[model samples]
Target chain A: MAINKIVASVEEAVADVHDGAVILVGGFGNIWNAPSYLLTAISKLPVKNLTVVSNSGGFGIEIWGGVFGVHEHDVEVLHRTKQCTKHIVSAPTNPLVVNTLETRYRAGEVEVEMCAQGTLAERVRAGRAGLGGILTPTGVGIPEIQRDKPVIEIDDRKYLVEKAIKGDFALIRAHKADRWGNLVYKGTSRTFNATMAGAARVTIAEVDEIVELGELDPEAIVTPGIYVNRVVLRQ
Target chain B: MTEKFRIDDQTMALRVAKEFKDGDVVNLGIGVPTLASNFIPGDREVIFHAENGVLGYGNICTAGEGSYDLLNAGGQPVEPRPGMSILDHAESFCVIRGGWLDWTVLGGLQVSEKGDLANWMVPEKKIGTIGGAMDLAFGAKKVIVVMPHNTKNGGYKIVKECTYPITGFRCVDLVVTDIAVIEVTPEGMVLKEVAPTWTPEEVQQLTEPRLIIAPDLHEIELA
Candidate 1:
């Protein structure tokens, strides 16, 4: 039988994701690009001890909740519901924000691992490309960041060797996708979603529109279907 | 409370914006650096690159006028200019890591005589995040910093060596502060220009490292 990559529901798309799973959520602190439906669904599940890797913890949190009515659920919902036990993110929150993941971090409720934005994306890319790691000049001298990592010196400059980060599942938002899962993204929303596409064992995309396989222009597709396991329409 | 000695944020931004060459692709870090984008002379066609993904984005829009999909790295809504193009995060950093960016203006908490930068973390405060500052600091052809001359409590930020964690070593080329425009040279900090009310000697008193006045030192132009 021919395989169908389309899932009937977002819940079913993320059904296999359970406790202690390393899941990648894609977005760059913008509500439009974030996988809100997937994130919202994840919040409802009984999953715990999830290590989430993303660019920012969520968008609009600094706005003291969303100024715009676009986002259904920010990543903070997952933290609030106790679905995520740890977060490996770059821009977590502004220090001034009243209620943030930093509060939980201070309480030792959730574990937080900070990664540089470029390093985070590159590490995830490395995971998909089957590379050992990346040697970057970022975070080389920082005691907290470089203390435990291996350092490689090239051309008289020292670089930290960051290992690739692979997720058990990836939840990404895309602008358009075909039945075969070839995806296209819109504007700033494309930040981390396209990079996180294949960096996981099962890459599930939540898209605004799903077209026929041949409908999407080849040049416009950011992620090929080969990297994607399932596609669900955004609510 | 009139403080004639200090330049306002816009003046500081304009001073740094004047350094941009025509056709230069500049990445402006948040705060003072972000303000530089507003002061870029209309005659110069500088492309603004936001690490969030877009290149050639225009000014930050007013609250109701913005399209949520279009935003800068700081998460503020912006309008993309004619030549603007948006790419993914990896490709955006590729522009930085590949040494394609012409210049990047960042804010610094502390800058050493050797140009070592420490802008991301202040351990005393538990909350901090290192975004693309490191990549931009090392990747750009020229790394310039726009910051205050001293801390809020009147402590020097330009130091002999940074007490905070280092972001990039010997990376900063220029320093634009409220009181002075200083250049980081191999020998030491060169005082290029000072605020009109403040003399180079006065600015030197606030700086931790010894300031060497340039031969053609002049006051910052406010016009």
Candidate 2:
């Protein structure tokens, strides 16, 4: 049997996602890096009460369309359509605009669990690496972040113990991928996409180009095929 | 309705830029701190780090010049310089959390006499974005906050205690406002330099905390 993980379409790639699933959406609030097709497909699904973990709660597709001059969806579709019940994010609201997530959060339609960006990354990394948790000094003094969390003193410095964040699915964007799902990224597009690659049980990659196996440079692969469960080429 | 002679935003940024040393790695927050990049001295080589995963990037690109794929922490496209490296978000925070940054300039909502910082949110909004501010606040070797001395309604921002939620405890090292340059010392907030044509008494009148007058206090120097 050949090791082919490439799927036919974005809809087919996310077909197995169910209601109340934990989804890790990639990108740093930019259309170029976001898994727009997968997000659109997920938004069209009947699934409800999703838990979205990302760096931002998204500023919506229209705002990004204005910024990049492209009509692409972002994680905001989840909140706009009322599919997401909770958002575990670092930046949940944009200062310039009142995004969909903020609107929903204010209306008591959605919940938010905010974390520092670095701590969010490390938590996802810990999930992928099968670690228990991490201790850091990022939120030592803030009561809102330190509430009910255990604190340990290391070398006389207080550190908060942040738990790992694993997801049911990870929707990521990549520059290119092989049939076997070996992925490489371009520029800063690699931000959270590369970080959430293997941080979930099922990692689905939406890539710009899909090549034959062994076509990708052996030394240049940012995410090996074993970590990727499926790959779909962008339309 | 009295007209005051406060320094402008660019001049405040220039004052903050003077704190940078050659070969120093600095992370700049959004707003006024981002403006400091434009004022870095020509003779010195300062590496700029963005939380979104680019290091040693050049200046912010004008419209139609840079690609959308390359953006700073502020979500603005920036020029790609030689020796610049792009990594994933995880690796980018490693540079931040690992304490490799020599200085981090952030815009402040409020700073306490104890050097506590509260810039992430205003309590009335009921929603705040943490972003990378908490990490940058606690991780950087030296933290410098730049903002106006008072709120739009003429309320003090540099106070005896921050009423807004704190970003970091005892994290602020220095503060550069529109009217004065204040240093957060072990004893209290020290008034180090005043803006031209502004007196220390006038600055203290708007400030919430009592300021210790530095012996060598002078007018803010951009050079």
Candidate 3:
């Protein structure tokens, strides 16, 4: 049988997500790179107590209104609707405005595990590559970040051991994808989307355009179809 | 005392920009450090790296210009430059953690005499984001911190030790503030230059740690 990973709708794409699922939402805190449709579908679901791993906690849809002139939802929708209970993130708070994650965290409504940005990326990559963990120099000597984590010395330098983080679902945004789910991204939109492509049990891609198989240049594919489980088109 | 002469943010950034050498791969953290990209010497070639997967980007775009997809570390839209390459977050940080960056200019809340940097969080809030600061602070070949010399209420930011959570240990090489330019050295924090009309003694008054005045201490020069 031929492989067909395309899903019918955004809601159907996320239908099997259970309560307390771990989700990896891709984006660098901007609408351009965010899987807004997928996140919105998840937000409308009754799923609760979710774990979200992303770069930023999100600036909410309202924050992007000034730039895009259209209010588009981001990962913040998950926090705003109270679907996510825990967030593993690098940058959680915006310096200019107090986002939903900050408000929820301050009020003790949610939990946050802060990791360095590079360390977060490596952790996700480790999950995809099936590594046990990564020894990084990022949080070494910082008491807050180091807090009880094992430290290993190599070549006369101290490194911290950070465990891998694998998610049950990865919601990613890409510029284009083929029927086989071969992906290509544009500009900086590739940030965490490409990194989290295969770092989950189910990797769902929300692309701006879908093309026929063999349409995507063989040499230019950023993500192979084998890493992706499903593809959805933007509405 | 009369209002002490202090340079503006742009001038401080210009002074910091003068430190960039030709062919330097530099990363600019958010805020004032982001302004350094606008002031790099015209004759020099400096590649700007953003933590959000863009490298060799040109400058912050004006209103109604540039794509939202192309942004700096500050999330501001930027112009695409020739020879620009976009990578995923993993490879973008590989460039950072692999020690490919020559210099990284970051904003600081407090910098210790030992070059400890604490800029990510405010202790009073009990919640702050680390972002990519830790890796940038530890991974860059040299780290430069740029901020005002003191807090809004006249509190010392350049201190003997950081009270807030630190971003990295012994990583800062230079600090450019509105009132002075100080270099971190084995001996201590060295007061290299002061804002025009401001004395080293005046700068030290706002700093928590005692400064070792440079032998050739002079007024800050932007040109």
Candidate 4:
């Protein structure tokens, strides 16, 4: 039988995600580009002890107004449902307010690995590229960011070694996709989604619209179909 | 209410914007630094770099005119200029980590006399987030802190030493606050400009580090 990438629903898309899974949610800038349908579907399923990686730690009640409604992203909903075991993120705040992650962290209910926003992005990209790691000077002298990481000096300049971060599954969002799984992102919603397309064992995309093959302009394609294992059209 | 010889946010931003040279590339932090873009003079074409990925965005977008898709690093929707380009997270950080920023204006909780920045977290708060603070502080050619002279609880922010977690060590070059503009030099904090109504001695009382008054100390003017 020929492989068909399209899935019936968000629940079916995330159905294979087991407990203790490491999920990387793509997109930044609130939930405008986040895979909200996939996130909401995951929130309803019986999963726990998950490790979530993203740009910000997650969203809170504050940023519920965007392209999507107030259902919340997988990161925030995972924390709310006590399903997340840890988070490796750059900005962990809920933007303007204290969030469940903060409370859970303080209460020792979850673990967090704080990283620089850029380093976080690069590390994820490195994972997708199959590189060993990234050497950056951004967090050289800072103690908290260094976190006992190795610092090597090249040409008398110092750089910290940050390992690549791959995930079991990468949840991404795209503005448009062709039946072949070619993706095109719109505006700033293309933040981390493009880099995360091929960085995981399984890459799933929740797109606003899916067009017929040959409909998307070849030059506008951001993520090719080979990287994506499944495609779910947003309900 | 009695006059406190204090400046508003816009005035503070104006003072900081004057520091940028023509054709400089700058990264503005979330709060007070966000206002500096509005005060950049028309004659000087300073490029504003938002970490989330727009290179040449001009100003904050009014609510009715913007979609959630065109936002700055602060997550506020903004308008892109004539030469704006969008990049992904990896490429955006390449701009930051490559030392392309000529000036980075950041807000601080405390700045030590030794130029250590403690801005990402409050000690009492159990959970805190350090977004791009470390990266900007480490890679920018010059880091200028823009914040209030004192905490909301009336404690001095420029201290001999910081009690909270440090963001970057000896990275701050200048600090623009509500009451005064100070520079972090090898010797100590140099008092450069003050509010018109405040005296040097009065500003000293609010500051914790010993002030080295500059020979050309003058009042801050916003034009």
Best by TM-score: 3
Model 1 over residues A49-140: C-alpha lDDT tens digits? Answer: 99999877764343534565453776777778877889998877754463457777777888888888899999999998999899988787
Candidate with the greatest lDDT versus the true structure: 3
Off by over 4 Å in 3: none
- Recovered fraction of real interface contacts per model: 0.80, 0.94, 0.97, 0.78
TM-score of chain B of each: 0.95, 0.96, 0.97, 0.96
Better of 1 and 3 by DockQ: 3
**Highest DockQ against the true fold, candidate:** 3
In model 4 chain B, which range of ten residues has the least summed lDDT? Answer: B1-10
Q: How does candidate 3 score on lDDT?
A: 0.91
Query: Could you tell which candidate, 1 or 2, scores higher by DockQ?
Result: 2
DockQ pick, better of 3 and 4: 3
lDDT of 4 by residue, A4-101 (tens): 68888888889989899989989774777788888888889898899999877676544575433655564687888898889998778754667778
Candidate 2 chain B worst ten-residue window by lDDT: B34-43
- For all the predictions, what are the DockQ values? 0.74, 0.88, 0.91, 0.72
Error of 2 at A218 (Å): 2.7
Model 2: per-residue lDDT, tens digit, B74-178?
878888888798889889899998989999999899999999999988999888988999999989999999999999999999999999999998999999999
Candidate lDDT (C-alpha), each: 0.85, 0.91, 0.91, 0.85
- TM-score (C-alpha) between model 4 and the true structure: 0.94
* lDDT, model 4, position B61: 79
Q: How do the candidates rank by DockQ, highest first?
A: 3, 2, 1, 4
lDDT of 3 by residue, B123-208 (tens): 99988989889999989999999998898888889999899999999999999999999999999999999988898888888888
